[model samples]
Target: MPQAVICAYARTPFGKHRGALSGYSATELGAMAVKELLERAGIDPASGVIDQVYMGHVLQTGSGQAPARQAAMNAGLPVTTPCTSVNKVCGSSLKAAMIAATEIRAGVSRMVIAGGMESMSNAPHFVRRARRGEEVSYAALESVLVHDGLKDAYTGEAMGNAGETIAGEHSISREQSDAFAIRSHALANKAWDEGWLDKESFPVGGLERDEGIRPDSSMDSLSGLRTVFSDGGQITAGNSSQVSDGASAVLVASEEAAEEHGLPVLARIIDYATSGVESHRVMSAPIPTVRNLLKRNGMSMDDIDILEHNEAFAAASCAIQMVLGVSEDRPSDIPIPFRNPCTVLVRVRLAISGAPDQLSR
Candidate 1:
């Protein structure tokens, strides 16, 4: 069956944890993006064309229906529309979109909304190693698990530790990682300056600016920072994407539905896949996913016009880039954009809080 087309897409500027959007709940962020997407498509949220609402969330603390339902209701979608919550780690949003597209292809539904939200600033924290609670006296055990107690069930470690392991195993040097991070910042800055992203982002609580771009960046200062996970480990705060708070949404509709509604198509997923690797080697999952995508399309790296891997960690990003035979170095042997990107953004926190605005040098 022909793929569904993306009618509209919108995202809150990924917010640095506790940054400008600390006050807004994830539902609010999702709702804001949903509303903007509908407006972009010239449709009202109450339009019954929407068949389902899928929300991707990793960290959440509250009692109620899934965040997807909350977001849909808050965005003013019809209450009768069905909703589902999906969790695929960072791939959740894309997966949700794919599912909606599949449903459209199967004649299950004509249109749907899919996307994600994560608020690291408000992520629930809990006592360390609740499994060890048995070792503590019975009287003291109950209180220890308080405060939305939850822990990583796999390694009994936090996500940051997993990131650290990815760095060490990949042998991604701190210098190299920091350099890649600077490039991300520079590319993002350029993308903003050139208006490549203007069409994709929405205002949140009146925030119009991207909170992540740094005006000043330098390499010298970045190379001097201390490592975060292990002594002498290559990864550092400068090279990692901050635990961010933000949300994004995209509208998908069948070709017939699009014609009926008079909506424009942005792009369609030609092919997509997801895989699971060892939890400790979580960063490696994308490698297989990309390979499968290429295999299915019978295409190569050179065929792709753009690659948007989540920069979960510098080490993970670099490792995947190299394994895929993608070059980070410029053809001239010098970084394409001239400037030290690390020092410029080490302290700049980006997040969702306002409308999209130009970031000047």
Candidate 2:
């Protein structure tokens, strides 16, 4: 019975781009989340039980050597702890936790830490001429910060532009997309006001709550905004994911190890999986991923109670909804860093285990 189990989870409140978290390095932000995870697990930082650290990140420009290692060190973990950095774009942190679960299932490591951190504002611009080895010429400094998330590798299309493409391909209208955005913001605002996020969120960089939700957002305003990616595009700032800064983390271990450490089982990691899509439709990979997960687990979309969609683009979520036939599910499109699946897993337990009081938030 030594299967992988999640014992504790925590996340820093998401900050806006160039907002509260802009000045800190990714390692520093990750360290705070890691420390909180250890605290929630009731395990000492110096405990040798932690076998490794895995962190996901996208904007790694100017982030120092072995970023995860640095984050663990900064969190007061022993230098002997191994660390690995993963970059799978939007799915980075989610995949990192899945990999940790596999390690626990394989019995290679009992206790491990997995999470992700991102600081879009702090991502550095680079001097490309230095790398190209030009002898003498006035050259412009290019920024990976700008290009990394913006440009797709296969077609050089910006993520927003691709969102527009998906929108056009799927025939998702501006009204429908705007409705999703408005509802997402409303739910986030309600969650913040009701303090549903307090258990999982802690203050970082002087920010105590999610900084991205627009409290005054309305359909009228969203309808008026011009599309930035293409002239006739349906995608706009209102309908796309807010560029954000924050981190989320969880402590995972085998079931036997959890008993050994006297830790409560927050959730069990089950049947982690992934799938691919056509190169051009990369944003919609979650459709096949959800289908494969359900099929292998011998379940259907109707068997599920809740689905939390990380908001990347309204179009992607809408398209996936149409494909997966889960459009009727209650809205749980939590923001990325503050709303990692580790917390979702825990919430699922609370919601289903008759803990109504706890699930009310």
Candidate 3:
């Protein structure tokens, strides 16, 4: 099989609620990130190098038309370059990248641009067509962002409620959740301070750093945050992931293309698989999926240097940790650490290979 490698990537700093990025639409942010990636790598999308563009988006809200095509055109890519949008919820962009890689591996596309975008702050409310009436009476209006994004149609369970249920099953406590949030913020803050993320971040609307990190946050402050779901639930506003806005993109190319263009390869494409958990226990899907990925690769948790799980709620990370028998300490063992910033959490298991020695150091 042919190989596809991610040559370069870029992303905009995650904007806080109604922050600087509010003015731009999700498609614009996505285009900005992709353009930045191409600029840094000196690749011209109009040069016939890019074969296709794949974008993942969860909520379009006010953004109109085909977001992927809009994003590619917005990024100055030739209109002739075909584009497709993938909406796999949280893993939309990641899945978009996977799709791009698959196309390259299948020998169909030589080079492709893949990424995801979201504008949670701009999520719009709408009234169904059936709700419209000739009378000037108030019709029922539903929040498309909330109902379609967070609420499960099958069980009508809000994502927060699902987190609470998972917490109860795994005995994850509020204190533990708080601690995990604190650690995450601390790590994020440290990374920002060290300028480790500068390589991948693009300046957008004057927001250069992640707006969600609370450097001064402590256990006391976290403990005081009210529970967001159940009356006695372990999930709290502080422990739960923030509703953020941002976009990211990566340039995937086949081995021949990469060598011809003199682009350095970071990692090779490996096996990818997905699984579905019960609607009530949706967060546990990663447990079985990761297990299957590892099993297919003939490896286990001990063999994985890094296992990046999307932390939608503190309970989610805890539940995955418990089921996978993985301790948090092992993450540092990997040479490249991934910090995912997305509302929907997609479990990605990357088996690192072919990284330069500078990264290992």
**Estimated TM-score for each candidate:** 0.82, 0.91, 0.92
> Which numbered prediction scores highest in lDDT against the true structure?
3
lDDT of each: 0.65, 0.74, 0.75
Model 1 ranges off by over 4 Å:
125-152, 329-361
Model 2, residue 298: displacement in angstroms? 1.1
lDDT of 2 by residue, 1-361 (tens): 3688878788777777788878887788899889988988888989778998998887777897888888898998998899998888767877788889999988889999988888777777776667667764445666676677557778777767767767788889899888877777777788778877677778876788888788677889989999888898888888776667777788888999899889887667777678877656776777777888989999998876556666467777787777777764554444432332111122222222223333454
> Model 3: residues >4 Å from true position, as ranges?
130-139, 332-359
lDDT of 3 at 232: 83
Query: Where in model 2 is the C-alpha error above 4 Å?
Result: 131-139, 329-331, 334-361
lDDT of model 3 at position 306: 57
Q: Candidate 2, which ten residues in sequence have the lowest lDDT sum? A: 340-349
- For candidate 1, the lDDT comes to 0.65
